[model samples]
Target chain A: MTYCVGIKLNAGLVFLSDSRTNAGVDHISTFRKMIVYERPGDRFMVLLTAGNLSIAQSVREILQTEQLKDPGGGEPVSIWNARSMFDATRVLGQAVRHVYERDAEALRHSGVEFNVSMIFGGQIRGEGMRLFSVYSAGNFIEATAETPFFQIGESKYGKPVLDRLVRPETSLDEAAKCALVSMDSTMKSNLSVGPPLDLAVYEVDRFASEKLVCIDMSNPYYRMVHSSWGQKLREAFDSVPDPVWQGATDLPLATESCQHKPLRKIGRPEERLI
Target chain B: MTYCVGIKLNAGLVFLSDSRTNAGVDHISTFRKMIVYERPGDRFMVLLTAGNLSIAQSVREILQTEQLKDPGGGEPVSIWNARSMFDATRVLGQAVRHVYERDAEALRHSGVEFNVSMIFGGQIRGEGMRLFSVYSAGNFIEATAETPFFQIGESKYGKPVLDRLVRPETSLDEAAKCALVSMDSTMKSNLSVGPPLDLAVYEVDRFASEKLVCIDMSNPYYRMVHSSWGQKLREAFDSVPDPVWQGATDLPLATESCQHKPLRKIGRPEERLI
Candidate 1:
């Protein structure tokens, strides 16, 4: 299992990925999942992957040197030379198809799905910024303004935070903070998603990024977020009013005069459930 | 899809279940997932089911009248007649097996797995309160001091709070509050789990519980929780500091002198990923 998130906000893009991987509980290992491709004055791209590690690794390796035929018989399109993020993502999709053709049949014989998914996003000199979620079938979907983020692998546990906090207009620094908080929530609940995170922040239209960093258990910012978020969350929970089961309050939990029908307990074997 | 949780703390037990049922996105209905069997001063049991609604409803119906034959020709053990919470759970397990026997094959023919799970807990007069997670195979596992809660269906999204807060000594009110917060988190992320929730809280050693209530979107307390939790969570998130990508803070996010090696951006097509 893995957890990786990529957000394309108005100000910038934020990418975060956990480094833990496991074939089973006893065989867990750490493998970083983010790779950056930068042509400082031309383009900057980041790839975050999850799913079968072998499949993902193969796709990533192939993508570095992979290219696609220019349907118009021009030069081959590769991530390094693509004019737009969409073309770069197509090169990635082609790489994934190449890996599928090479490994899918043998993997199927061993009962393994040829599965890998990726979040590929970046800014090319001529365009704004773009982000896509590429699937195992060599298909992809671009993120829209209304949905400015993409998450891959073990996504649900950390999703509520993103759903609530991430927005197209969020600032670069704040989006990075939200992504870390989201990752922290995920790591707390899931053992398979462990430490040693890879994070990169790219300012929109910059055509480059210098905010690539690795974080582990001792990273001060992360440690503070981890401890303080839990403490503050508990304090927030403590502030809520506990239900006064049968009593009156501003909000009656179960007042005798309430309009909605409450569930009636069955007092005998023959009683009907209402 | 569904979300139901049963928690046992020193003070008592808490059970909560969402009432939404959907065959797909287009076909959704409200079918309550909690059933309370209470014979005051004798026994109090709560059954929370998740998975196939039909299977769960069938098992609940069977459990009401289902009986297990006594090996020595004593009276059959039905949930109503069971002497211990454990015995009542066994009756529930037997009911699950009966349903599987009758419908698993037919369900499989339609490509539906015999998918169901449950959390059954309560007390009989002579023993302490017990909580269990029953499986599709009719097997079950009891919650203990180390792990005093069980959640079924769409559980991951809501699990972090329970992991952070619930303990053997947690107050019943706090646990109930925590359960509601957890449910709120699940509903925030998942469309399949929705409102019209059923909640029941039981006091330890009490043979019956009178706190079963149905909560809907209009329920004032739930409305408060929904808005307050979301607002407070956002406030809590804002309380944390944003990442200072390159410049120095007390906790340097990516200072030039940092010890860990940052991810290097590949500047050329021939560059190797390190």
Candidate 2:
């Protein structure tokens, strides 16, 4: 199991991934799921993967050298020398297809689905930052202004905070904070998604970034964030007044105040709400 | 897809279920997923179902009359006549297995898996409150004091809050509020889980309750909860300070005061965390 998220905001790109991988509960191990490719001032791309670790590792191994042939008899297009992020993602898709062709049959014989998903996003010299979610089928979808983020693996536990906080216009630091908070929630609720975490904050158009760090259990900033967020969330929850079932309170629990009808009770076999 | 949660607290029990059901995204409808049975001053039981609606409906139909023959040469045990909550759950499991035996093969031929999950909880006269999560195989796991809650379908998005808030000591109203908050989170993230919702809160010894309500978009309390929670959540998020890469701010992002270690970065392909 893994948890990875990528956010492409107007300010920059934010990527985060957990390092836990498990074949079963008894066979848990740390496996880094992020790869950074940088040719300063030319191209900068980060890949975050989830699903079968072997397949993702194989795809990564093939990706650096995998190429799509030119129909016009020119040099093959690879991630190293793609003109646009679209072309680079196409090369990645080809790499995934190559791995699938090599391993899918044997894995299928053992009843394993060829499951792999990835978030590939970064900036190239000519264009702004772009983010994409690549599926096992070698198909992908790009982030848009309407939905500027993508998540893979243990995504649901952490999604509400992202839904509440992230937007295209969010600041880079704010998005980073939001991502960590989301990760914190996931880690709290799910045993499979554990730290130390890998976090990268890339400023759009820089073509390179120095804001990459690995966070472990002992990290000071994360400790503060984790503890403070949980405490504050509890405070927030408590601040809200509990529903008062009786009359004349600030908020009443009864359905009479609202247009909605009360729930129907079926006391007998033929009793129905409709 | 659906989202239903049941929490067993020392004070009582809380149950919540969304009404949205969809064959596909194109065929969406509202179908209540909760059923309550009460023999005043004797027993109170609630069932929340998720998975194939047909299977659940079948199980529900059979459950009313489903019976298990006593090992001793005596009468049968039906949920209506069970002496204990455990016996009632056993009857529910038998009903599920009956439905599976009738429909699973046909459903499998059509490439649909025979899947259903349920959260059943209540008290039967001589016994204290008990909660069980019933699966398709007719086996069930009871919720304990350590794990006093069970959720079925689209559950993860709503789990973090429940994990944080639910305890054996939690009040019935608080548990109900927590369940609603959990549903709110699930609805915010997944379109498949929606309202109008069915919620019921029952006290441990009270064989009947008036706290059952069908909360719709027009429900005043729900509207207030949704808006206030969303607003308060956002405000809580904003109250957390943003990360400062290198600063002397009151809550420094990269402080050296905690036990956790900073994140490690790999500048080259060969540089690995392991």
Candidate 3:
């Protein structure tokens, strides 16, 4: 299992991925899941992957060399030389399809789905930053202002925070922090998603970024955030008054005069709520 | 789809369930998932079901009269006559198996799995309160101090808070509050789980409880909690500092200078990370 998130914000883009991988609990291992492609002042891209490691690695390898045919039959389109992020993503889709063509049948015979999903986002020299979630089928969906983020692999546990916190206008650094918090929630509930995170932040239209980091359990800032978030969350919970079953005006959760009845009881076979 | 959670604390037991049921997103309706069986002052039990509504409803119908043979050749043990909470849970499991025996084959023929899970817990006259998670296979597991809660259906989105907040010593009201908060998170992220929730709270050894309520969108207390929790959570998130990439302080999430090279860039099809 894995947990990876990519957010395209007005300020920039934020990418975070956990490093744990396991065929089974006993075989758990750490493998970095974030990859950055940077040409300093020219272009910058980040890829976060989840699903079968072999499939993802193959796609990554092929992605470098994968090409899409040009409509005019001239130079083929590839990620590095693509004029727009849309064309770059098309190249990525082609890479995924290439791997599928090579491995899907064999994997099916072995009872393994050719499962792989990725978040691919970045900027090229001319266009605005774009982020997309690529599916195993080689199709993809781009993020928009109304839905400015994408998450892949074991996504639910980490989703609530993103649902509440992320916005198209959020700062790149804040979105990074939100992603880590989201990852933290996931790590707390799921053993399969562990530490040694890879994170990258890109400023929109900059064509390059320098904010990249690798975080392990020993990282000082993460430790502070983890402990402080927990403590502060507890304080917040404590501040909320407990439900009072019967009350006049004090925020009681349940009152005697409410229209809804308590659940109906059945002590005998003949009893039913309906 | 559904979301139901049962928690056992030193103060008592808490059970909460959402009322949404859907065959697909287009076929959604409200069907209450909680059933309480109490011979007030004698025995008090709450059953929260998730998964196939038909199967669970049948189990509940059969459960009213379902009986387990006594090893000692005494009278058959029905939930109403069970001397221990354990025996009542066993009868509930038996009810599940009965439903499976009757419908599993037919459901499978139509491509539906015999999917159903339940959280059953309460106090029977003579024993301490007990909580259980019953499976589709008619097997069950009891909650203990180390893991004093069980959630069924669409559970992951709401799990992080339970992991962070629940403890053996948590108060009944607090646990109930936590359960509602967890349910709120699930509902926010999943369309399948929705409002008009049923909640029941039991005090240890009481054999009955008065704290039961059906909370709909208009319910004042739930309205307060839904708004307050979301608002407070946002405030907490805002209070946390955003990531600072080039800072001097050693933050746990700070970018580390590493011997490992940055991810390889691809300027053309020939460029590869390796």
Fraction of true contacts kept, per model?
Answer: 0.65, 0.40, 0.64
Lowest lDDT block of 10, candidate 3 chain A: A255-264
Question: What would the per-residue lDDT of candidate 1 be over residues A75-181, giving only the tens digit for each residue?
Answer: 99999888889999989999999999999999999999988999999999989999999999989999999889999999988888888888899999889889988
Better of 1 and 2 by TM-score: 1
Rank order (by TM-score, best first): 3, 1, 2
Ranking by lDDT: 1, 3, 2
User: Where is model 2 more than 4 Å wrong at Cα?
Assistant: A249-251, A256-274, B247-274
Model 2 CA lDDT for position B19: 90
Clash totals, every prediction:
0, 8, 9
Docking class of 3: medium
TM-score for each model:
0.96, 0.94, 0.97
Candidate 1: tens digits of C-alpha lDDT, residues B217-245: 77777778888988888888888888765
Q: Clashing residue pairs in candidate 1, if any?
A: none
Which regions of candidate 1 are displaced past 4 Å?
A: A255-260, B246-248, B255-261
Segments in model 3 whose C-alpha atoms lie over 4 Å from true places: A256-262, B250-252, B255-268
lDDT per residue (tens digit) for residues A96-172 in model 3: 99999999999999999999999999998878899999999999999999999999999999999899889998887
